[model samples]
Target chain A: MGPATQRVAGPAGPPPEPKGAIMALTQASGTRTEPRRPSRKGTLTALLFLAPFFVLFFAFTVFPVLYSCYLSLFKDKAAGLGLGAVQKVFVGGENYLRALTDPAYTSSFGNIAVYCLIYIPVMIVLSLSIALLLDSAAAKARGFFRLAFYLPNIVPGLIAAVIWLYLYTPEISPIVDAVKASGGTWDLSSTLAAYFSISNITVWMHTGYNVILFYAALQAVPKEVLEAATVDGAGPFRTAVAIKARMIAGAVSVATLFTVVGAMQLFAEPLLLKTKATAITSTWTPNMFIYDAAFDKHDFGYAAASALTFAVLIGVMSWAVTKLGSKADQ
Target chain B: MRKIRKTHVVVAVAGALSAALLAGCSSGTAPAAQSTRSGPVEITFSSWLKGSKQVVEAFNASHPDIKVTFKEVASSKDNYPALTNQVKAGNAPDVVTVEYPHVSEMATQGVLQDISKPAGDFVKSKFDPAAQSLVTFGGATWGVPLDAGVLEFFYREDLFTKYGIEVPKTWAEYEAAAAKVATADPAVRLGSTVVGDSALMAALSWQNGAKWGGVDGDSWKIDVNSQASMDAMKVHQDLFDKKLVWADDDPVLQKKQAAGQMLSVISGAWYGAALRSSFPDQAGKWRVAPLPAPTSAPATAFYGGSTFGISKNSTKADAGVKFIEWMTTDPAAISARIGGTSSTFPINTEANAAAAKTFDKAFFGGQDIYANAAAGLKTVPSGWTWTPGTPTTFSKLADGGAQVKAGKATLSQILDQAQDATVADLKNRGISIK
Candidate 1:
């Protein structure tokens, strides 16, 4: 996961050539040279260098993942008003069956589906359009625009949600007042309005970060191809749509993948909104359902089972996105 | 042979490193063992209530034999998870503040010490029967009640006079006043419903004689959807359906309250202090009344209250009980606690006079609010036992109330849903149900 993120972030820096061009060069050189195994001493040095990451990763990530899987198979049962000693009993497949059958847990997926349907396309289009405008020659102060766009992303998600919460509050918010002044009702207490309100927060916080990604990818578009399009009677709009957008298709797919994963893990924003929005229950999203199960109900076994189920769903979605993304790139 | 030796050396180094990491992570403060060798018995107290620090200081000053270390935690909603986690981790404090609804839940989960032997007699003598019932569950005294949050009606005196409305004395009259206020002005509401305050809803249900759940001869009886509970909730649902009351979480509720568009609030006795502090400009306009009941008999229930319980992990149970009894019963401790903005009605009858003397009644127009609260406290119905899955039951109730606000479901339906959810949860925990 760490190395994959680094690879994705690699294009954020200025490169002398396009990533595709660099890949082609590497591939050509790879056919000319014979692969050789490193010596035992070299391998030992590499292991020494990687040891810290491996240790921390296993302790923090791998161990908990495996432990939760083990815990999900057992449950704590206390008899007759639970005053006596509690006992941990192995209940194979029961926790998972209960999680699947529970309406509240299952409905949380429906809530996430609504959130993702609204969040993903809006985020992708808004960021891509802003990146295109920033890349155009007619746009002014590219550096300032990029920084201004990325400012909200730098603010932590919790802090950003809090700031947006203030704006969503009717008594204190000038936005709500302005809407009311114009004879419009801005009600966030309803379920559909809450979905839009939460999606608005995520979009505000993330569009700028993806704008930078798309902007960097747009920069790597071969200048000759764009110039050739311009010479062939193609206007800037046509050239941008036909040449630049196609070149950065890979970046768009990556952005969509991240946004989909993010939408599936929607928690902090809706959880904060739950304080004010009556429509958002404690189990508004899958993550919130798992959290309420573990902490509020003290049903760690059920929480673990639901969490593992959600993880598998996310894994399959991510894999499908990657497969389709690569096919689109081709 | 050389490759095997290298592999063995690598494995040994990794194992040693991981073991060291695990040891470092697991090293925490050891539980204080029985204080036989101590010059003074040391115990840790954790609370988030206002004036707790002052009370702890008073206890430490007066009691030389028992030394207390106080830790300020977050409010109850955020504190319970941390408290239970600490209990599970075996490093919980000696004494902690838990609410009435959570006492049974925590006691049943083995997070709290069964203090029957140490504090049972003292609790029976010092506290009233209603307060005593709140702490004693399943034949064991789990905690000592610090306050009795007797439900009360806080209304705008000037608004009621201007609107020519009488102070409601029954549920039927309250509904009439709600409709009258709506007719007088669509913008003004007689009161508001707190859709997310399951405690407030539970108190309302209790006033109507709803026994949510209780232990019945070693088995639990789950009855959240009783006739009384439905009748109590139907009134709120009717007001919500007619838009006569504002949803408490709506920002407009605050706006209306500040602008004098909202006429009343139904909450515990502590809310008088909150109102005075929150709306200082409307200080003289507010008055307190006993909560209107379904009948004229004047029944009430506790809205919000805290109790002190010793953690099961603490070995210093006696020291912890001494601290709790002092905090709840000692007049000096009660006075110190009321020296702040807190208006908690102490369950200890003897300490009420001390609390009233320090509490400034100038906020409620010099009305003897404590006397009014005491009158209401006497009317609280008993036999309302909070079962083991209170956290789940409350959240479901709150969610149902939310659905009511969203116009998605009625309160009666939500009550039935909560009843089913509670029964399912208790059954899942392997608690025998009748």
Candidate 2:
């Protein structure tokens, strides 16, 4: 049955009329009723709108992770000059211990942690400040600025890496020569240089995107509040700080979280730069290291172990981001 | 307001149910296609051919009784694990391409069918012995010697003529000639070797009588830290010290080699095809000659090549053998694949001769590369084998060599460390070290 019918069936339907007025008789017809239970039809319509997103989320995100976790427990074994029998041994927790104790794995983790510490705060502040300027300005060509900022994200990651690789290369790179000409040596092949160079590429590529987001959020803030603040004694800077800026703490928190996750999973930059940089070992990043161990070294058990450890680390960090960012948003 | 509240309750319940159903549907997508087909006599053939579809189509056309399919694997490193997993799961390809350096690695993995007796009748006389020996490890013949990657010097005749210099017949003369060419124009240098390619290094070292590992009776002993290898390392050190070679690692070095930026290149027989294909305009300006010897001995060794092996998990193991036997043992298949394409020298002796007859001598400035490569193929010695752990060991050695090259460590110190590391790595991998 429809929700409207169910509500009318409840007790205490009509109110008492005032005696003297005939016009009051129409007012006495007012009904009192209880809330109706939701109908099945309404629930069905709501579900129809939500189906697509949940389908993708479970397929791509959930299943493979569980499968990999299962595979991580078994070790592949070959017997007798590798020309005899082969077997899979299930050794509980052994693979994880081996991965944890591996120097390559530990070193890669340490490298990523240091990278995150340097990159996250710098990216967050720079992007936030640029976003604020772009938001606060009375620029006429807002769309042009938005497009200019988002252009880097459109460039394929591999292509960007290849272009940056050449620019960083000292052999044909005029940029390197320019640096040297000014009494500075810019070698992107060293440990410190590789980190800085990769960070620069990340900042150049992503800062524009963050700017677009911050501007969008700023535009959503109520204009009257900012106008009132400005009408009082507040200047543009003070108005932004007192009213509009406080409105984008949520956006800032979200951007900071994204930067943290991206920094931890740094792969393409390090991978492309590996041949150029002597210091960038094959295992310079955890993902690359796991890949090398599995494919290059042909040690799947070890690779799976390392990958699971990496996943766990990323999981913890991602959880922390969501928790802290959402709490701060509230 | 009551009706609205009732609708909200109804909507939320429906929403939750659909979410659960959608999640259920999505969770099973990747795992849905789990079982292999049951009806047809299906066989998969793993190959590294750039245009493998054409080959597979051609094979399928002649043999409709058995259906054959093919897949292109990324590279040896990427292919091995998947291949191993498939084999372990009882779903391996019938035929798999086993590159020369990896034949021993694969053979040791116990996923290769031993065709020793069937392969025994194949003539050692017609093939590059070194190429054949790499596949015949641990008293079992695991592959058919598909082709030989014998090294030869590809020199620019125009540059030689411009400098009024002759192609050097020995290492000392080659150096002298390189010095002369450099003197003629400081803009150009000698040659470039992939210093990072340990296989290339091992080949050169083997030509200089360097041994890696050997089986004595029932025991295997690794000899990576031998005197001959150390002596061979000196040649590379000398080249780097003199700045006679380029340091940047890329295929552009090969392009530079073509452009006469380098006078000569020490590369495999397949290098000829690359010259003809990549630099088609500079065809007649280039000539191939046999590598110059450092010593008085007339011997050489293999640098690289691909071989074919049968997967142990294949239900069509016999059919796979028959196919590889036809490709490797039959003269027509090898001749057409190698000689007709003018790609590499076929391992089949008759096929090599046929291929040699088809080669254009004008590309080499009238030097018959076929005749030269054929001669080099004979003098090539054979004493190398792959263990499952070689890739790891080689990568480690390369890193060690890089350290030595960078002056971070002395050669002796690096070698000692590499030796210890290799032994430990092999032991850990469960390879018997004697």
Candidate 3:
């Protein structure tokens, strides 16, 4: 969980724009390969130019991902004095089986599933509506509102979690005091309160970035199309919901995918709130589970096994999302 | 998958080249460290102890030939795992600090340098009997004894007087006192234990002479959730159910204790110093007593304790031993870490008088903490060996304990889960569990 993802999570107000990253990557690779087909010198020049990105991509992303999977297949075995020598035994699928069977590991996914169930719908509606409101006549100080709304997204995710954690703590938090002042008790220590407490953080950190996206999409909508609709007796609500939202369906799809992925990797917020929120455990989320395994438990094999599984799951989910989006377009 | 397979062939060649380069460095360092031909020997010490730097510096002052640098790692529970990773990565510190509960795991796993040939004599002669007893497993002393982590009760004297609660000398008395305190002030309780903190519970189990984890012939035995552990668990469960103790610790408990909302905290002497900084206002109101046990036996649990070990990867064994010898023997080193703040309890019997002389009684309302701590440390029952998978076991138990508190499971089920998880983890790590 980070503030940077806030700016990355959504699509706003207009018809979907062409997918930005894939277009850039394909164009970069295609143009380079298409040129210099027969000449060795030309090919060498192109290769030299593209070397940095490929080398970095392979080393940081490709190699580690592959190596991590390789590590999962072999577990470290202690012999003699616990540290005398560590033997690497190829346990194959044992780590995976253990992770799958583990209640802690399985429970993390359960937590995230419940998190997304609460987060996605509320996030989508609130951001989309906020963007539409800004686009309509009622929202004045448009520039100020845009900045003010997006500012929460700018707070680093860890810092944002910390800030909200303080706001959650009864002894130190003014928010808790406010609730008490209102004759209401907010026991964030409970399981349900802790879940919503973290969900609120994810929403707070993310909603504005999506708002900005929607607002930008709204701006991109053809003025003539909206004017024509209004001339035929369409109101602001109809223009926003019927004409505008469908136009930005691609953006909405992208945001939904990001939300799903973000929901999957939930870690920092829950971890930071763990002290005040007793229900949040060491293995509260999949990321936390991986951290506990690799760092806390020192079982790298089990950690890598679970990590690879989670990675494959995300990859499949993203692909399915893209496939579904394309079919919707057709 | 096929494409990545093809890429792996090319990557394999690159990996071999890197491996060769790494081997080159390792071989070079080994020979250089083999002889006294080199200048002053240097070794790295990794510990999370608060004043480890001062202790190391004191060692450096005494032994000019051995220049030791300190690398501060995480707290006790996290330190071993991090050190294990470092050792596996082949970039380990020459000297590593392991805690009481993890000593056997480290010792038997063969991760440490066998100093028997060189430093064993020094350890047998100089180390504290208890600390020495802890590190000796499977026929060798794996590390140097550092300090005592004996448990003690730090209670608010003023609160006890106000509530008219008697000083509890037994578990039953402790419960009665808790009940009295809770009735006197509904806002505060006598104490609170973190539901997820299996470390505290394990230590308490140790007081009952529970062999929760230990080596069994050629295999490891994970006997948590046994009669002894269940005995300790019963006390904690009673505390939780009766609303006599909180399910939290300092910072969270700090505010309550500072405001007299929480009356006492029964933990190791190391935590006593923490009280001064966290709640300086509560001074002169608090006092220290030996932790209560069943039947007034004066038995105490060891908590948050550590020992110093030399890594097998270190070629400088003699230098490492010399440094450890000085740290354990020198009153100056122990004195540098004197008081509860720096984690000093004079595990070295010789340093007791000096440590007691430098002891700061101001924090504990003039209570002779060192004297009482010595008495408590004297009563720690032996045979409380640790398994390498203590952290693994505790993490599960911690989560399981939370589940129990949440009404998702029962305490017995959680302990059983801890036992099963410990066994599975030990097996995974190649610790025989048959």
Candidate 4:
């Protein structure tokens, strides 16, 4: 069967290829004696195989991104009490200027900056430590523990935030009750408290998934190197810190990169938490600013401009993270 | 070769899958064309109000020529985004539910159709002038009013009597009652701040003769932090400062009520039904009264209500307007809605008796809430027009309220901020502000 049929058949189908053969096949193709010429018939076949993906991708993704860019240049202008027909007036860079100048929109960047500072380090350290513990030889029930650690990631992020919202609310939370009984006060009414509460949720939901990623990278370390370390009188802690961690530095860097991007796109958690926490405003994050502009204010042009600006910011941040990550890996 | 044949099969499969996807995308547009030639003119109605399904069923069962398909959406805050998105995507329902405050904004944005030709006369003749003013803007009708949420005070009779606090008649007495409740028990509060509900805050301001903004000749005027508005807001701020009320949304407020920590709530007439559903255990203890006025003169304002508008993209505007008319004015539709325990005060004067008859007053301890609502409705000051930047105004006000709650700012400062932010937003949107 062709690759399409195999994919459609899913898990019930026979293996598409032996796991190890993929590596050998790539090597074989790379070391061909002569470069094969692309025949017109072969090119036609390749295009036919790629047609569906290109069509769906262009329809859903590329067009919307381009259309939003176009929409960002023009705004709807109404006259005479705004009950008459509206006109789309093109004003280049004006929307972007407005978004940049608005204090609420600019402050949202500060909110996410603080959020990333707390969320990223805590997530990386906690997940990496857990990965090390699970990878150690002394750990029992490795398979069960790995699955147990990964379970929280399986719950949708919005659902996870909702569950955490209940746990954070003062009226219904058992946590708050316990704290009060112990002569302590738990309140999420401050901006700092909201930041930590949101960070706590992201860490809880994502740390487990990162653990699995780091653990898999740790498993791939060669046995001979680890045995050599043991022969050099390296204890469990030394081996874990010096050998396994060094071996999985690439995985850790990749996880950090992903976490940075995820932190910048914080919308749903804070949006839900804003109901309970008086400190969390409608424009608490970049995405929420776009949402409030578009839906609440009905200023789609400003929303589009803010969205594009936010996208460029995210792109620059991602590039910086990748550069830093690769430098750390080297 | 074998690979060539496999590629051919893959190409065929991909083509078929894409064809299926294309078919699925085209199907949404096909029904509108088919309905034009069909037996019944099928129209889609989107609403989030209670008893919408029963009202649609009742309409469909009675009418043979027109059929309505009801789609339930989230509350107005969430639904407006979805509605506007649908309008932009060219897949909007024929009838859409919009709140009174949002009508001006939606109509100005071209999300709703100007149904002045089809249903304006009916709206003018059937609905009162106050209701008519809310729907008609810039010499055109954009929607049909369903209910008028006249402000009322909901209190627990048992708690008020036990605390020896008479129902408040003026704002001064209300403050005294709040103080009395706090002195009697530190746990119980007399009322709530409703910190995030800008609508309630606006209603309070409106009751105290605060005209936030209105059209002045050609340009729009916005005065959100007017003296009257600040005076009304400061009362609540004082209560908040004294810790005499619980500051929370409805869900948390309901929890406080269940714990017997909150004793009363100042809300719209519709909240009477909501109180029953939310606190069914305290059914016999609750009572409805007119809202306390700032002066000896009794005055109130509309708080929470919705209207039906035909989407600008709908090809069935006539059918949609018919459905809206029936839903808003017909006794049968009123009965069906009230049967679901919706205590909405219908804006149609003729349908008020029908709705009042159908509503279960036993939930409010047999108190005649309709008479109180009618009294409250008579006192709603006129000449208060909603601006296109009202949604932004409310959101900013709510944010300001949050700041006040956090002790970073006061209510008066937030009012100024809300006013300045709304003016800036309007100017950004190319709307003229005076």
Off by over 4 Å in 1: A1-49, A325-330, B1-16, B24-36, B248-251
RMSDs, each prediction? Answer: 3.8, 9.7, 5.6, 5.2
| Candidate 2, B10-64: lDDT as tens digits | 6676578667767654552322222245543566788764434554565566565
lDDT measured at residue B357 in model 2 versus the true structure, 0 to 100: 71
Q: What is the lDDT of residue B191 in candidate 4?
A: 90
Error of 4 at B117 (Å): 2.7
For each candidate, give its TM-score against the true structure.
0.92, 0.81, 0.89, 0.91
For candidate 3, the iRMS in Å is 6.4
Inter-residue clash pairs, candidate 2? A38-B6, A43-B11, A82-B108, A82-B110
Q: State each model's CA lDDT, in order.
A: 0.85, 0.69, 0.76, 0.85
Runs of candidate 2 exceeding 4 Å displacement: A1-67, A166-188, A220-250, B1-43, B50-70, B73-78, B88-90, B123-126, B164-166, B169-184, B216-220, B251-255, B339-341, B397-421
- Candidate numbers sorted by lDDT from highest down: 1, 4, 3, 2
Per-residue lDDT of model 1, residues A223-296, tens digit only: 89888888899987887788888778777876677577767888888888876666899999999999999999
Q: Which of the two candidates, 2 or 3, achieves a greater lDDT against the reference? A: 3
Expressed between 0 and 1, the share of native interface contacts present in candidate 1 is: 0.76
Give me the TM-scores of chain B across the candidates.
0.94, 0.83, 0.89, 0.92
Instruction: Encode model 1's per-residue lDDT on B269-352: one tens digit a residue.
Output: 888778878888997888899998989899899998999999988999998999998899889999889885778898788888
For candidate 2, give fnat to 2 decimals. 0.25
Q: Ten consecutive residues with minimal summed lDDT in candidate 3 chain B?
A: B25-34
